[model samples]
Target: MVAKAVVKPAVELPVRADEDSWTEAELAEVRATLEAEMAALVAEIAHAESTIAEDGGGDGAGDDQADAGAKTYEREHEMALAHNARDLLVQCERAVRRMDAGTYGVCESCTRPIGKARLQAFPRATMCVACKQREERR
Candidate 1:
């Protein structure tokens, strides 16, 4: 007698479809999108860090006064931009973590499933459209 080998399907994050449990396919699609976003954000953060380090000059030595001022300004600007990138990266990581925890589709504010269209555009979003708008108005 030949033994039959069974292949189990991969487990994926749960996504809500029309207020119902998401099929494995839907979850897989959303998971792929979120994972891609997380990877891109991490790469962007790394690039920003390296660029900031290259532009940063700790001491004012071997530079003219005007050049030093320009370097200082540029460093500060670069640091601010890098900080924003880091913040976005954090959000992306959080979203990925939520996916792993089986809570990826819900809004953090109202505990509702985030809209599908919104998720498509912003994979790292933590709030639903209503909550986001309310927060913005405050």
Candidate 2:
């Protein structure tokens, strides 16, 4: 069976970023993408936490050195995955907040419009390409 697509209400952005014009369709699409990604990331974080707990709670009494090391590695790997997911989740949340605050597509550093193409490519981006590159260099 085919899954039904969710119909999200169009986002009414009162503030446009600089000279860039964002249509209601574009804003709705971006909002949908961000919300979907956020949901997936939350699920991933929960799964990773469960995996880490299961792996770390085992007693090592019967395990040899290799087995112990492998379990430790798996637990650490899950922790890292969870950490990355958490970071992404934070970014998504911040983007949503910016959208609500009427500053979604504006570059935080340069106060310029982050191009629509860039935002379409990375919904969580808070800076334009130039500002991002400069930030990376610093």
Count of backbone clashes, every candidate in sequence: 0, 0
Report the Cα lDDT for candidate 2.
Answer: 0.82
lDDT of 1 by residue, 39-119 (tens): 886787788778888766367778899998898888788778778877877887777677666677688899877865677
**lDDT of every model, 2 decimals:** 0.72, 0.82
| Top candidate, metric lDDT | 2
Q: How close is candidate 2 to the true structure, as a TM-score?
A: 0.84
**Residue pairs of candidate 1 with colliding backbone atoms:** none
Q: Candidate 1 local accuracy as lDDT?
A: 0.72
How large is the C-alpha RMSD of every model relative to the true structure?
A: 6.8, 7.0
By summed lDDT, the worst window of 10 consecutive residues in model 1 runs over 5-14
- Candidate 2 lDDT over 6-30, as tens digits, reads 4333343323344346677788788
Supply candidate 1's per-residue lDDT for 16: 49
